[model samples]
Target: MATTLKNRSWRLSAAALLLSFSAQAQAPEAAATPAGMSGQEMLFWVLVSLLGVLVLALVLTGILIVVQLRPQLRKVYEMPTVRPSWSGKVLGLFVGDPVLLQGRVRDEIMSGHDYDGIHEFDNDLPPWWKMGFYGTIAFAAVYLFYFHVADAGQLSQAEYETEMKQAALLVSVGSDDPNKLTDFQPLTAAADIGAGKSLFATNCAPCHGAAAEGKVGPNLTDEYWLHGGEVNHVYKTVKFGVQGKGMVAWKGKLSSKQILQVSSYILTLQGSKPANAKEPQGEKDPTATKIAMR
Candidate 1:
């Protein structure tokens, strides 16, 4: 009776140990899941992969359809051939092949002409050249049809004026009035003056002279001033200008800052004497403040 009881207990213990081992094996699998990636994540990746494969399959199928259908469609719509003369074939080889060159066709014929011992073969121009010539004719016809006959895009003088007025409204331009002059203030920094000097050399040197000694205009180097000598005044004069005096208003032509830079550059020219200074014009007031243009 006791042996029977011990055997039953051993069997129960063995079964419990086997179940614990199974649970332990399953616990590792549960713990192995990454922080961000769960079973749902794995399923999502698998679904994405399947979708990519499906898309690739669809693209391949489309390419196959196009490859199979193109030649059959072309065969169905084959164009009739226009035969050329024997002389035309010979000329066609020298220019490009007629089939290779679009729309060029040969129609004229030329036979061999023999004069004494000399023999020459006369041939017509390639069909390609003829077609090109004909294309120009067609283009002219179309252009004339659209421009003159249809008059779809034609603009009347009033319409053109209206368009010009609208376009002019979009742009900000300085006043055209000679009496209302624009002003440019000089930049004080040496770096700014240096940049302005370079700019003047490139842009203003032709008319104003390289050293700012007036060639077509007044001298900037000398204290004897024609227009106002103040920094802001000079800036304004440089930007706008004396209307009848040949100095054009550079307001729209140059940016506000660029004009200021040029003004600053002109200021640096003071005291540096150039060879031929234009005789100073305008009254020199004794109380005229010496303003730094740079």
Candidate 2:
């Protein structure tokens, strides 16, 4: 009976061993991955994100370093306090220490004179001014060395001439076209006749009646044209007075367009009856045109 039990136990052990081998054979193999990241892509992404954060942190640290260092760099370039020499020291003792001398001198100079104990010193320029003057001389010497002798940042005569020529080219007047004339032609619209009327009333009303009837000057309302009736010609005559004629040219005072508008307004006066119309003086207009001045 004991022998039989041992055989059964051995059979059970062999069966268990076979079952373990089968399980091992059936298991899936792990896939090969670059950088040993297989099956842990999430962890890999987390590590990559951390690296980017670290790079950004480094950049911010660099910027902060630059900002903190700037003021220290500026201090490096600032002027240092100057120490007085033997001569300056001696002068300071007699004139109240150099540091305090400025205030003392200023007080003495500004203090009013008294009748019994009268005393006053003329206001003098501060020591800072003298120092500044010396500094200016030093700077001028340095500038002369750099710009004249060393030729550093200096403009040659040829370069200066070229620059001047370019500037002249930009603004030089090239032609006498009417469009180029900037001084004349202040008004150009037909509606500006009202403005012309005002001007005529103020200036021409004394010679020619307010109604433009002949008075000291020839009748303007009549068709008898003294000078050319054209607008341009009338503008010219108004701008430049006719030689030996009473009309004087108003070129410099009134703009060309203003003169033109006034001329047009005058044409509108043709044949209009005024309160007092002078008898016809010059040759009548061949056109026999009639216009109402209203």
Clashes (backbone N, CA, C under 3 Å), per candidate, total: 6, 7
Relative to the true structure, candidate 2 has a C-alpha RMSD (angstroms) of 25.8
> What would the TM-scores of all predictions be?
0.35, 0.34
How displaced is residue 126 in candidate 1, in Å? 93
Candidate 2 residue lDDT tens string, 5-55: 455545555555555556546755563455756558955774576566555
Per-residue C-alpha lDDT of model 1 across residues 152-257, encoded as one tens digit per residue? 6555775899997887777656544334445544577877787788888987888778888878777777776777766666777777777888877777888778
Which of the numbered candidates is closest to the native, going by highest TM-score?
1
Worst 10 residues of 2 by lDDT: 175-184
Off by over 4 Å in 2: 1-190, 287-294
